[model samples]
Every structure is written in C-alpha cells, then in structure tokens.
Target: MKKNQNFRFEKKNRTKLKIKIFSLQIMEFVTHCENSESSTTSSIIPEMETSSQIVELALSVERADTAALLGADESNIDTLEKKRLEEIRQQQISQAKLMAERRQKKAAMGMEERQNWEQEIERYRIENEEVEERQRRLDIDETMEEFYPKLCEWVGLSNYEVLYNSLEDGTNASDLNKKICGEKNVMFIIITKTGYAFGCFCHKKIPYPKKSYIYSMYDKKYFTFSLRNPSCSEPIYFKQKHKGKSICIWPNDEKNFIFTTKRFIKIKNPNGPHGTRSFFHGKFSLKYKSKDHQKREHTFFTQTTAFDVHRLVVLHWF
Candidate 1:
C-alpha cells in the first residue's frame, strides 16, 4: 500500500510541470507574432506614402503644361480653364517656396559649386539667344520668299527676265553660242546703223548679226516690239491683229533678214514652262555686236551695234 501511493504522487507532479512549460511556450509564440505584424505594418506605411507623393507629382506636371500656354488674363478663360489655371498658380507658388529653400541651401554651399551653377545659367542664356537669332533669320527669309512672286505679279510681269548685265561688240560668237545652246524663248534688242532701235521675241536663237542687217523672217509666232529704252516697263509690242504670221516685207538686200543656215533654223517659242535658273534683277542695255558672216560659224557677229542685253533666260508665263 505505501509503494502504490508514492508512485501516484510522483506522476501527478510530472503532469503539472509539463502543463506549466506548455503555457510558457504559447505566450512566447503570441509575443513573436505581434512583433512580426508590427514590423510589416511599419514597412507598408512608407510605401503607401511614396505612392501618394508620386501621384501628386504627376498631377502637378500635367497642370504646368496647360498653364504655360494660358498666360493670358483669367477673365478671358472659361470656367474649367480658370479652375485649372488657379490650381497651377498654387502649385507654382509652392514650387517657388521650395526653390527659396533650395536657394538658402545653395548659399551655404562651397564657392566652387556656386560658381559652377552661375556658369550653367549663363550657358543656357546664350543658347536661348542663339536659338532666337536663328529663328528670326528663318522668318525673314520666309517673308522675302512670299514677297517676291507678289512683287513680280503686281508689276504685270508674266515671268519676265530682268537683265542687269550688258555685252558689247567683239563678244566671242563661240562664247555666246555656249550660253544660248540650252536656252529657250528669248528677247533680242538691236540698234540699226540709222540709229533706229527694235527688239524681237522669238524661239530658237536670234542671229547676232554685226555686218549683216537684222530683218524680220517668217515666224508663225514671232513677236516684234519697239522700245524707247530697254526698260521692261517701256515695251511697245505688236499685237496679233497687226500682221498675223506674214512673210518678211522688207527686201532681203544686205539687211540681216531672219533666215536659217544649214546648221540652225529660227522658229516660234517651243512648248514648255520656262527654266528657273535666275530671275534677272537689274538694269539692262545693249553692250556690243559681231558680224553676220560668223552667224553660220559662231552663232554671233562682231561688227554691228547689235544692242546686246544680258544673256536670255527661259520665259515663264505667270
């Protein structure tokens, strides 16, 4: 009986000791869980604040773009735009305050960094000035381009050539030929031995007759005109109702009658638009003349006062 009672007491004490140890373990687990959850919550709070800051920054940038272009009076803006501008102005004021704080911080910086910042600002200013100058020149060029065609049309010039150059007698026939080879419809002004002056507008090349006199030939589309002077504004051209493709009436004695050699034939203007090599812009007059004997040889002559204006250009009808 004494052994049985001792065994039961010892078993009861073991059970009580296990229960106390289990209770301690459960309390420690609960404390550990609380600390882990607190740390996770603290980490999530900073991320949420960062996301909200990014959203605010994006919205501010969006407002700035619209506000920059809406620098006019708020009274002129509609209600929606007015509201947007008001918001932008507030954002700008805040930004200005931040800039003021930054300026204070910059003032506390070293002299080297402050000098570098000033140099950066100067570089940006120079770049802006250069951009403005380039844009000004481009605008001037565009204005001039628009003005030229209008000026030409206002003067009643249907794609007229203005020659400022003068050529005289003794100009090489070969040189003249080289210049006129690719040329089209042309105008020629001449002074006769009797001091009479006449000009012709024809196709192909007009003969630069020096010894040979220049007279009219049969051209279906030739236009003859008399000029008091070689001024473009002073032209007196013959109308089509005058003759209308008649044969030369003047006797072909020594007068340089318009005819063709075996090499070249004169005719009316060819069919096409004019060339755009130059818009001759200046004073024009007769310079020199060559002999008609060289007409077949050099396409020019050297003896007559063939009032040579500047080289002919392709005529475009406006």
Candidate 2:
C-alpha cells in the first residue's frame, strides 16, 4: 500500500512540472506577438518634424518669406534674392519712363529745330558763294600783277616810253581813229581777257587796227612755253608751200580772220629729229607748244586793251 502511494505522488509531481512548462511557453508566445505588433506600428508612423524639412515644404507652397524667417539656416538667403529681383524690376520701370519723357521732348522741339536748320543751311550757302567770288577776284589780281613784271623781264629794254596804255585810254581801236594808234617807231603789247598777250612794233602809222598788218614791224614771234625748244633745227613753212603763205605779215590784228588759216612764222617742234614733219615741207615743222600766237593777234581787232611796248633793238627769241 505504501509503494502505490509513492507512485501516485511522483505522477502528481510530474503533472505540476508539465503545467508550469506549458504556462511559460504560452507567456513567451504572447510576448513575441506583442513585440512584433509594436515594431510594425512604429514603422508605419513617421519621425518628428525637422526644421529643414519644414522650410522645404513652406518654400514649395510659395511661402518663401515664412520659410526664410522660421529657418535654422540663419543666412536670410531668400530675403537677399527677393531684394535683388525687386531692384532689377525697379530699374526696368524707371528706364521705360525716362525713354517716354525723352520722346515727348523731341516731338515738342521738332518744328523750331527744323526752321533753324534751314536758316543755317541758307546762311552757309551764301557764305560759301561769297568766299568763292572773293577768291576769283584775287586770282585775277594776281594774274594782272604777274603779266607786267614778266613783260619787263622779257623785253630787256634799257630805255623805253609808254606812249599809250589801253587801260588808261581804251582797249578798242574800232571806236577811235588811227590817232589813238601810236606813231611809227613805237611798239605795242596787247593784254586781253584771254590769258596770253600780243606784242609788235609799228613800222609805219596804221590808219585802222584791222589793216595794221601792212605796217607791221616785228619779224619774230613771242610766246610762253613750259618746256624749252632746245634743238637747233630749221623751221618748215607749210603755208608758204601748201597754202601760198610765204613772208606773211599776218592779219593778226584783224579779229575777223579765220582761226585755222592764220599762220605764224615759227618752228613747231624743235625738240629732236624724228619722222614727225609738216606735210609738203620737210626739215621744218611749224609746231606750237604754247597757246596759238595768232589767237592772241585776233584779240587786237576787237578786244585789244591794256597794252604797252618798248622799242626792240633786235627781236629774235632764241
């Protein structure tokens, strides 16, 4: 009976130990489930809000001023950027207003300025014309002053008499008689509106200026040239051989004479010997380097004025 009682006690002790072990297992399972649920809930929720994240959200909503004031950056970078943009906008507005004001001022002054500009142009043109006319007179004065001094040098006269000067008397002999024409043994130099001159000695007292060739005294021709005729070649007389003009006392004083037909006793080209000779007359070509000597003579008939002369000892232009 005691052995059976010991066996029953051992079985009861074993049953108690199994019950405690089962309770421990159940407690552990519940704790693990609670921990997992708590971790999952924590993961679903969010962390506490930071200052930079709040600033970013505010700026995204176009509230930069609020973001900048409440920011932890402490730099006020947004405020500085706003001020710079405002300044640029103000500058553009001010420039547009200034340009409008300038346009209005120019429109108001246009008519008065146009009138003044026209007046200024007219005055300038008149002043320019006056300057030109003054220059022309000065040129004529210079030419007149030059001709007389050069005449004295060319004539090389030791003693001479000025019996008449057309400038003092008159240039035209057509109105006056032969009394105005100087006496025999007198010489003459005619100054005309044309640039060149005409000069000769009167062998006898001529009645009319047009018929003075019959009384012509001078044998040599005189003219001005830039280049000297240095070649010592003989002269060719084309008019004498071709046109029956030999030993001519040219009607140089006659204004009505034909221009091309008028001839002078002179060699044309005395530079060098070449094939360039006058027609019908070789070894002599009546070349004219300067102005035509007969052209100056024609002026004596109509416009022969302002002339003076001296007796030539022996006139030969060499």
Candidate 3:
C-alpha cells in the first residue's frame, strides 16, 4: 500500500514538472514571436519612408512637366511648321513652272531650228571673244608703237622678240628669270596707275651680277627713261649720272626693278593688293640747256615723287 501511494505521488510530481516545462516553452515562443515582429517593423519603416520620398519626387516632376506644357506656345510651333511647308511648296511650284517652260520652249522649236539657234549662239560667243582679243591686241600695239621701236633703236637691238608682259606671264621673279635671264638686252616698261610711264634698259643680262645700292660703276649701256611724263613734254631720257650703274632686278618682296640706287628709281609690289609703288627722283633725268642760259631746275617724270603702277612689261632680245 505504501509503495502504491509513493508511486501515485511520484506520477503526480512528474505531471506537474511536464506542465511547468510546457509553460516555459510557451513563454519563450511568445517572446521570440514578439522579437520577430519588432525586427520586421523596424526594417520596413525605412523602406516605407523611401517609398514616400520617391512618390513625392514623382509628384513634383509631374507638376513641373504639367506647368511647362501649359506655358508652352502651341501656336508658335504650328506657325513655324506652316511657314516651312509654305516655302517648300513655293519652291516646288517655281521649279515645276521652270521645267514646264523649258519643255514647252524645247517642243516649240524644230530640230533644224534648234541647230540653227545653237549655231547662232556659238557664233555670237566666238565673235565676242574675237572682239575682246582684237581690242587687247590693239592696246598692246599702241604701247609697242610708243616705246618698242624707240627702245630698240636706243639699245641698238634690231632683231628682238617680246619676252614677258606682267599682264600675261605674272609678276614673279622666278618667272621673270625664266623668260629673260639668258638674253643680252632686256627692257622694262612700267605704266603707273596715274598714267605715268617709265622703264629701265639693261644692256647686260637681267638680274645683273653687279648689284649696287649706290652705283654699279661698270655698266655704261644701262639707263632709265620716262615714256610718258606729265611734267615733261617730250619723253625724257635719264643717263646714269653716278657712273652708269647696272640695272638691278630685285626679287621676293624687295622691288620688281631697281634702275638706280641712292636716290633710286624703282617699283615695289608688282602684283600686290595695293598695286605697284614707283619711286622716281630728280637726279634720274639728264640736264638740258635752258633758253635763259641758266641751269634748269630738276624735275621728275611722275611730277610727284612716287606713284602706283598700273602695268609692267618686260621685253628681251638676244
């Protein structure tokens, strides 16, 4: 009986211990669930805040776009498009009209008539070109008559040929040398813009070896002359006073032709934008006897000390 009583008491105690362990497990599970819930809430709060910020930004952008749309001028865009289209339409119409006119003109003419018309146009073009060429040749002939014969006579060169004209060849030094370097006699004729004309005669080959800023002192045949002078009635000849200096052929931006040096007669910038600048001095001209038995005052060809050139012509003969 005592054993049965003790067994029943132990069984009751075992049931009580099992109930206490189950209660403790339940409490622990509830605490774990609460912690999980709290953690989830904490994690979600920042996400929710970010989403709200994004929503606010989207709303602001939408409002700004809406304001821009409202403020924009639809009429301006429509007007610009219409104007562009109208211009295109007008251009197309004009082109169509031109094409139709051309076709109608073509159709109106017979094949023979078209050939005749083309021939007539060609004749006119040829005649025009011929006329221009004749006029140019006439002008050159006049210049030749005025200076060519006289220059040849003075230089004692009968058999000669035209070498280089600036209007035809070019105003380059290399080109000048190519045309007139080997020749024994060369004459330079320069006409100024102001209608004054002058030139240099080099008996020696051009670009004479004896270059002098003062005087060449060796070349007796080298001389300068004024063809057309406003002050002088006749074409005045300038004998080289400082012992017949050889004419200098200046090159590459120095001077086109240098007749004398130290009170020099020269032309600068032959083909430049400002045209050619010519310098003439009183000492260049030879002194003449006056009627009053007195020394005539020195005079230059251009009247003025300097003038701009109009044309430069170079002729040579072997």
lDDT (Cα) of model 2: 0.38
How would you encode candidate 3's per-residue C-alpha lDDT over 47-162 as one tens digit per residue?
A: 32356644654575578778888668664798889999999999999999999998888887766698899999999999999877445433545666766677667888766667
Model 2, poorest ten-residue lDDT window?
A: 309-318
**TM-score for each model:** 0.22, 0.30, 0.45
- Expressed as tens digits, the lDDT of each residue in 1-318 for candidate 1 is 889999999877865554454345445656766777554433332232356644654465557656866665454568778789999999999999999989888777756687888999999999998776445423423322433454333334446443211232222333333333334354444332222233445543343434443434444445444433323223344423233332212212322222222111221111113321111111111111222222212112212223222222223223
Q: Which stretches of candidate 2 lie over 4 Å from their true place?
A: 1-144, 147-149, 158-173, 176-180, 184-213, 217-318
Model 3 local distance difference test score:
0.61
Model 3: CA > 4 A from native: 1-138, 208-217, 252-262, 270-276, 282-299
In terms of lDDT, model 1 sits at 0.39
lDDT of 2 by residue, 1-318 (tens): 999999999978865554455445445656766777554423432332565743444354456556766684557777788899999999989999999888888876886798899899999999998877445423434333444344444445434454444334332233222333434334333222222333333334433344444333332432221110113112111111232222212233333211111243121111213321211111222422214343233222223322122110112121
Candidate 1 matches the true fold with a TM-score of 0.22
